[model samples]
Target: MSKANTAQFFESVKAHGFVRRSAVYRWMWTNYDDLSELLKEARPSWIVIARELNGIGLRDARGRDLASDNIRRVWLRVSRDLEKERQAARAQQRPAEPATSAREEPKRFNPSRLPANYRPDVEIKPQPSVPATSGPYQVPASIDVSEVPEFYTRKDGTVVHRTQEQRERIAQQRAGFEKETRHIDRYILTQKAK
Candidate 1:
């Protein structure tokens, strides 16, 4: 059925309650006059006028009941587009056969028909290496003496010594020593001088 007639559309939906067919008819007629006037000054499209009325209804203090009306138009547009796409897909699927000979050709591969030593001629370039941003991996470079110990012990009574974190430990101990010395100096200076 053609939904182009707003009056008939409203009449068909008015029986759902909250809105009467007479009220819908009155609204359409009132908006029609406004739409005509709008078409003159700014030459606005009918769609624009209709959308404006919907926006006003949604924003007006006494128009809370019309909130769903704005959504109706948006939903209608979406549903119509979706329906068209679905119908097109269904129509395409209903076709039983292609109209061209290329659609009937079958691809076949016989691996045994080729020579036993047949090899495709291809120039293979080495893949470029990308440096990893994050992951567990080992570098091929020699380990620095400062990073690893010079020796390590194995379970077979093998003793190995490796580079130690002695510098870090020494620096930490020195900082603590300085802090304690400062506190002692402060206590001594703060005592009453006889």
Candidate 2:
């Protein structure tokens, strides 16, 4: 089944990024006629129009309700197109009358504003709150590794440990380790000649 036809959607979603705008244009282009009909019906309301779009699974790219402005833009375009169609039919069927003034020009239909306090009949359930328990981690008092000061050597033969004497011995034990480094680093390189 098409998402637009069956998926549950939010009222006016805030679409950002390319994906959302693409969805909007896709919905607009695909459902153009349906949207126009919704605008033309008696007792046209923006909220109702938005709801109809929602029914078709239209929403902000983020899956949230679309903003009113975005919905209004589409609504305005549909309503304007409808008006143009009506005017064209009138012009074609009825012969030309007196030269029309600017006021007579076919203007965009102004649908009544939705009631200020009006809200959708959606059941808004309170979001589940995470328990206020301590996070899944503990702050240790210190990272003191007092046991033996274990060490590891890097690929470049550099030794890392809690003491200089241990690092020196570890460095000498390796075949490719540099002796001069031990001298400069005061690691007792004298005893390990070659």
Model 2 pairs whose backbones collide: 12-65, 12-66, 13-65, 13-66
Task: Give the lowest summed-lDDT range of ten residues in model 1.
Answer: 133-142
For model 2, the stretches where C-alpha displacement exceeds 4 angstroms are 1-20, 77-194
Best by TM-score: 2
Give candidate 2's TM-score: 0.27
Q: Taking the tens digit of each residue's C-alpha lDDT, what string does model 2 give over 54-132?
A: 7778787678776667777865665576579789998899976778766686866454665767777799999966445
Per-model CA lDDT versus the true structure: 0.55, 0.60
Per-residue accuracy of model 1 over 100-146 as CA lDDT, tens digit each = 66767686767888899988789889997755523233222343324
Model 1 regions lying over 4 Å from their true place = 1-95, 98-101, 113-194
Would you estimate the TM-scores of all the predictions?
0.20, 0.27
